[model samples]
Target: MDAGGVDLDARRNTNAGTRLISMASGTFNASIQRVKAWSFADAAKTSPTYDWYPMYGMAVSYSGSNVTSASGKSISSPIAASFVQNYRTQNFKRVLFEYIPDVKVMIDSLSDNHDALNSHVIHGVSNPGAWITFTGDSAIPPGTIKGQAEGDTKKYHIRADEKTGEFTFVLPEGNYLTAGNKIWIYAFLNGKETLTSTIVEDKTPPDKPILNAITDKDASFVGSAEANSSVTIYRVSDHSVLGTTKADAKGNFTLVLAASQKPLVPYLEYVAVAKDMAGNESVQSDAKTVQDTTPPSADAITQFIQVGSSFDLKAKMLVTNVRDNAGNDDDNLSYTLLKKPDIEVVGKSEAVVEIADKAGNKVSVSVPVFVKDQNSSVSKEAMLQAEDFMVKARELPKDETEWDAFILKQAKARAWGVPAGNDISDNIIVTNRGVFSEKAGTYTITLRVKDVEKTIQAVVIPGTLSIKKIPSDIQFGMQKIRSFEQRIKPQEETKVTVEDGRSEKTRWQLTAMLEAPFKINEEEKLPDSLVLASKNMDGNIRYTPINTQGTTPVFQKETASEGLTEIDLNPAGNTGLMLDLMPGNIRSGKVYQTKIVWTLENTP
Candidate 1:
């Protein structure tokens, strides 16, 4: 039987004689030759060789079993077939011969127990051993690594170098590096972590402070320059404290100077210091020096004054030769006028004057003075005289009777205690003073110089004696008499008579009359009883006039008889009389006489 195509089960049960025939089938049959060669080649390389034919034949003869029976042939042939098939089915040619025995035993044992043979064969295969080499380890090296402290998480990346075995990290912009920070490098092989290096960031230093210089000329420092700064000023010579100021948020500073602290001395020195917010101090600027040595001066007034007949005093001031310590003449000086009580000023007589330094620095001052008349004495004297005359004239009496009584008393007092020889004997040189009639006489006084000697003559004479008749026989007209005499005594009486020749009938009447410029005490007493007619036996008179008791005297007569009329005589007369008359009766023979005389009596 050929092992290449033989079934193992059939060969195993074959007779012993058949084992040899099956084992030699490859060398005997030509057609089977190729199969036998293939089987032997496969069996010798893969399975163990055994003397199965001899062993099986001996066992069968000794048992005296019948050789020709179907069971014997079947067992012998199957045994040979099984040997061939086992070699063919093992496929152990790819393996070395040394492992062939192990393959057969595994296959025979699996066949006997009905187990799997491929599992046992695979278990015997050996693994190939290998040796590998790498360029460097994946461990991160120990060193310093630089990185940003505050940056984006994604931007903070680190990498390792293969050649140098060093790691590097990248940081984002605007992030500072700080100390005590760690950098990480990741191994992509197994996602393992490795720290690259420690970081040591640098610390920033503070900035330098700014320095500023401030002077009285430019005292104010404003805007950004004034911010984050401290200023201290000192007098340079003595190192005295001048002022100090702190800058505001906008870097502005303001310094106010007192009046006493102003650099009035001629050559003053000062120093300034400034410090910034970073605690840095600036270098001191150059010393600032100022002088104010000039004295205060006056300034002239700008307004004009108009001078007429009256003199007016105008005030003015002029400032010159005034200067400060810096040789500046522009310093302002003030003045004030000491006013006197009698002086008067015009409106807003006080004024203020301002003067500036050479650099146009200005100051203000005030001055006051009076604007008054210079010649006031002459006008005051003339006004005093006029006022005195008006006061004396207002004290006199206003009534005429009282005025006349006062004048008579003055004349009597002057005439008393006169010597008798002082009166001259000549008719024109009678006593210079006497009771003069104001109504009946014309009085004259004359002064003559004979042989260088002065003599005086006074004369008294009756005025023209003419009778005026009213309502005469020829015409109907009014009669009026105006009487005047240069000489008249005080309280004189004057009388006048009127005669009607028309049989004392025909009713002669009197009308309106007036006596002015003289006080006429009684005017109704015409044809007074003190006078009688040259022949009075006839009944020509009809009425007798009498004085009324306790009545103020009136000059105009309201009641009278028709034929004859009588009038009383009394007059407080000391002046001339003016009478206005009208025609009264219409008759041919009507005659009236205005006669005046005085009654003299001895003094008590």
Candidate 2:
């Protein structure tokens, strides 16, 4: 090779003693014989100051055993060839040499246990374009410099970047490291092994926490779980965290729900989750209900009461009209009467009713009782003197000072008014408002005490006597003319009413007489009528005729104590006008009329 950018090829053939020579650039194939030194003439410079040439060289040489020098001076089996450029006394060689070196692969980074459970990546530096492999649970042996050894060790392979010596091996999905288990990562690239080991923390989650009952009235949520575990209370309604706390050494945890930034919802379901120190979260606990804390309400009662009267105010009766929440039952309610009502008085009284539920909630109300005195009455007298009157009654409440706490009103008539200033003298009430004189009639008085009322009557006997409701004119029906005397009765019955208001010691008599005789015409006349009256004796009717002289007694009273008397002149075959009929004595077509006079006399 020479600086003129040319290569030299020398070869010797022994069969025909042939030898060939050629000039080449770059590499040369040569079999030299008896040659020790070689050189290339430097090319002349086109300009001494502006000369230039490209560097050229060969990295290979040819040596054959058939080569022999003609002088029999044998050349070495291999000879040196060189290319040099000499210009202006400077020598330059154009050739580079390279050799294979041992591979140096190292693992620089690996995922920790926590990260290995998620994103697992192995990082290392290696020769460019070199093959890389990762293994778990087993490390590549030291000083391993050749192809991979045949073994049961786990492995993963990857190719590094052609331009960069950096390599990475990522674990496939669903591959993870167990908690608290030590795992080794082995990276092999180009038969060079590098490994690193890490102890994986806990990865298996603890069991779900056991949650306690949560009531709306409670301030915290309490439960038990793994020791040193973090508990989070979540509102199932929204999956939001209500509060959080850490479990003690005894696996007991309490989360203060009242301390939460946002209020927790009532009557909603909630659950708890426990997170271990290794960041492992457990499944949610059983759902718990947040109970409500509202209490019940009751209504008031009013009852009308009287002395000796009993009222049943039991607990069930008190809660009959109560309003309560669904969480409370009517049977769970009880009542306590603070005080018994006073029913003996004729006034209002209060009964304090206090009702409570099983949850220790209470409601209070006041029940009013309208109390009235027991009813009382006084005996009424059919007749009384003009002096002061006394009343006899029953069921009257005792009075210390006065027993006249009663009202008086006229029952039948208001012929007189009671004085406003009337007073009771010797237990007798002064009932007259005018000049003192008792009227001769039955008078009724109403007695009142608070809300009770009673009635009594007082009759002031009069010194005078009178008769009322005199009997009307009597009439006899048509009689048949007969030879024998026949008795005929009147067509209608007559009635008479009498009253005797005289003193108790006085006697009275009543009499009746015929005022006019029966006459039909100037020339014809009816028989004299016999006026008869009937009286009841032992349930039997007895008829007796009265004298026409107006002196015979028809009805009479022995004394004023008899009060009022009445008599009926029933003509049914017994009483009323009786007539004697004879043949041709009465006319058939004639109408007879008669009149009767009644008199009353206060005698003996």
Candidate 3:
């Protein structure tokens, strides 16, 4: 073992034989092994420098005869069930603990009734500074709260660790330090300090709650506080508590409000109060007035409205004061129209109108209305008047035929009704047949007219008819055609006047003939070339001579209806005839006269 970094194996093997060469009686002689004289005079036997230790304790071990395990201890027999370990020497029992110096302390085993946290026994703890008592209850009683008051067991400090979530305290000495005390033992490593936390026992009641409002809804009174509570409502006057109602999750409650026992009433008021879970009562809510007393009025419908199918549904009615008694206090007033007798018919249907006020009180009235269809009816009697019954004609034949009912000018005679439904008044047809009485008496006829739906009768009353004529005398006035130039000019001839016939169907015509052709007063005669001729009202001429003396047709009804319709003196050449003279035929100066008979007859 020199300091040369070389192996010193010489002293390891055959160690006894190499100490010298002999084994004497038991050991070597001390005289031979000793150095008799030693000197420490100049040099001191002190270690020269510091160096690392050889770390000689062998941590690696194996199981063998005496050393049977890695813990380097003799293997003992299997733990005897009845053997007392160290009992003969010591009375205190042993407890194994896993302890890390200044780091952690865990109780792994216990000898007595010591309760540890997390089911771990606080084994081998010494000189405890704080102790913990864990009970089933979170509330620590007044006398039980240690170290909180003077004259109390101040050394027995108890606290619940808010950070570590543990109960720790200083265990009192003597009987208080006994096992099974449900206590925690904290080693005296650090001094005690104050700790604060929640307390389970709450003695003070909750704060005064607020009372918001109370209202009435139909048979119940309702209120709200927006809190979780139970409420009770009371009649204010009698101070009688009404039925209680639990608030909903949202704290809205409804209390049953009884109806008034008697009909006669001023409204009643009720008050309410709420109570929370802590038995704290809130102030009384506002007094709420509640009533639904008034029955709907105007139920006796005296007069009914008249309605037709043609009427607009929006039309207002004034038949009765149809509304509820509480209408002013209610939210709204509305009316519904229903068919009375529950029958839906077009004509004369009863309208059961129910009117409701906001309080849900309703009254129905039966209204009688004339519910006719939109179609209107017209009778033929309204179409005929007095004018339609009579005709003032001249003395006609007693055997006169019936005037055609179709020929009657309805536009001029018949009186018409208003246009209704499919009845076009302008297109109404009134058929009748009658002749005017000869002496102005009753003129009877049945007139039927069909409208949109049905046929009806109309009375054609007697109406008057008349006629007159003038200027019956037609004269071909005297004219002098002695000179040849005078004969060339034309003159206005004779014209006969006629009026419309009394019977509108009467037609007339004219025919003419001459005894001699242009005779001069029946003495001197003109030549055949100067014959008698007449021009029609239309400016047409015809001549006739004695040699050709056949009657010539003059004015005919078929040719022109002028004379038959009205006056023949129309401005459009319907009045006068023209006399035209030929120049080659001459006549001496003479006055002339002629006759024209216009026969008025019922021809057309």
Candidate 4:
């Protein structure tokens, strides 16, 4: 083709007929049209035989006016042919393409992760109509298929919301689910799957903590709880925290209280609580009460006894009185003698008493005792011939008072001995004069040695009772008998003395009576009676007439009268004897004589 015509003929075709056609729609531009050309063998002879030739050219339209051949040949009516586009590949470049993007699912946050549960509801956001599935470990599967037997492979499935694209899945209810269970979730839609969510199930709290019984003022609290858990001790009265600690791997814990922390109050209640690492709290353990450990005071127990007093060790226990801080009364306490005292002997001794409270706490106290008996007795003979009952050895007691007591007891018991450091000859004074009397009777001897006063009975037994002294004769002076009356009294030599040496007092009597009437001769007798006078206990003068019928009561003792007693008949003082003479009764120069009888009786 020429340059002008070649510019118009932009494309070429190799097909035999209907050469200008597109291989496929949209494979190339269709606005540019194609045509085939025809040629004459000899154009000089118009009528010569012609041959058809394939021509290549361009056209603006497939319609009548723009259609032509390379020679500008036009036909009034052209046959239209319909065809499709076609092409031949020569060289090409490579390309990579994708039809859809990946889909992701997000799981919602869980509310409770440590509560024991049989089933759980899972929520997430996903595309509509997307299926959500759950997978777990071989030991614990998520769930069985819906409407399927329980033996089926465990899995849980659900669909997203049709409008909101939100989905929920309920984990199957079974005992197989346990703490720390793992679950892998997947969301599938349009053959696309996302494995971006995984859940760890922990639905159990630690076991309740255990607390041991404790006492007041304990240094630490010891107990057991879940491994690696936190344990706390609380006072039950006010719910105050006493101590806290973390449990070891073996579930043992010891909470040491700080120095500033108050000690456990006695008789108070306490409890323990445990919390696990998963933020789960356990119930309180049983109450561990605090007990009282203080015992009754040893100093408060006291015993008192005077020296030389007797005591019975087994009859009465010591330490009966004591004070306790725990409000224990005497009835609730027990007394035990740890050491017995020597009470039989009269000396100082020590005793130990243990006092115990209701809680079994005990305290010991030492008590001192002094033993003595104030009343004692001794015996001896009156006058001489008393036996010596005391030792004269120089050995003495450590205490001067005790030595004095020992010496005094011996002297009193045996009725003869001198006190230590006193004159040996003083025995005469002690036995005969001091505490002892010559008169027969029982006498009480009292001696004070330091804090102790002792009394001893010194008994004196009499040897005999007899008349010790009496006048040998009584002389009445010569007198003349007259016609008138006359009276004569005895001389000064008339008297009688009696001594009693008996241990007991006895009654006796002394009587004086005329043996015969006084007479100048047997025919002439003086008055046949004589008068004796004496003083009574009230110091009044009393007179008795002596007669021969029955003995007149001259001096009679109605009761016991000990020691020496004397009676005087001399014409002196308030006692004397008198003789009366009547008218013409006496003869001049005539001798008058009479025998006086004195009788002594051992009765009133």
The numbered model that scores best in TM-score is: 4
Instruction: Supply the TM-score for candidate 2.
Output: 0.37
Clashing pairs in 2: 7-23, 7-24, 7-25, 133-156, 134-156, 180-201
Judged by lDDT, which candidate is best? 4
- Prediction 4 global C-alpha lDDT: 0.54
- What candidate 1 gets wrong by more than 4 Å, as runs, is 1-229, 235-239, 245-271, 276-280, 285-604
Judge candidate 1 against the unseen true structure and give its global Cα lDDT, from 0 to 1. 0.29
**Backbone clashes counted, model 4:** 15
Q: Per-residue lDDT tens digits of candidate 2, residues 365-437?
A: 7665555443322122111112224322221224522323331322211111111112222233424333212
Residue 344 lDDT in candidate 3: 35
Q: Model 2 scores what on Cα lDDT?
A: 0.51
Candidate 4, residues 1-604: lDDT per residue as tens digits? 2121211111233322322322322222121122222222222232312111111121222222212221211111121111111111110011111122245777764423434233356678887766667666433344443412122242437777878889876554532334454666776553345777454545456788899878766788899999999999998999998877999999999999788754555678889999987777889999998886876774422333444455565412554445665554566577777777676653335677787777788888776543323332211211111223323222334465454345454554222111111122223323222444344456555543222233545554445567788777667778776777655687556778877655556688887777787877778887653677667799896767676666776666667565788866674664778766677767788778787777777773
Stretches off by above 4 angstroms in model 4 are: 1-104, 110-119, 136-156, 175-182, 198-203, 215-220, 256-265, 291-295, 300-303, 307-346, 349-356, 360-366, 370-604
Give per-residue lDDT, candidate 1, residue 297.
44
> Model 3 off-target regions past 4 Å?
1-222, 232-244, 254-271, 275-282, 288-317, 325-457, 461-568, 571-604
lDDT of 4 at 494: 77
Query: TM-scores, in order shown?
Result: 0.21, 0.37, 0.28, 0.40
Candidate 4 displacement at residue 36 in angstroms: 40
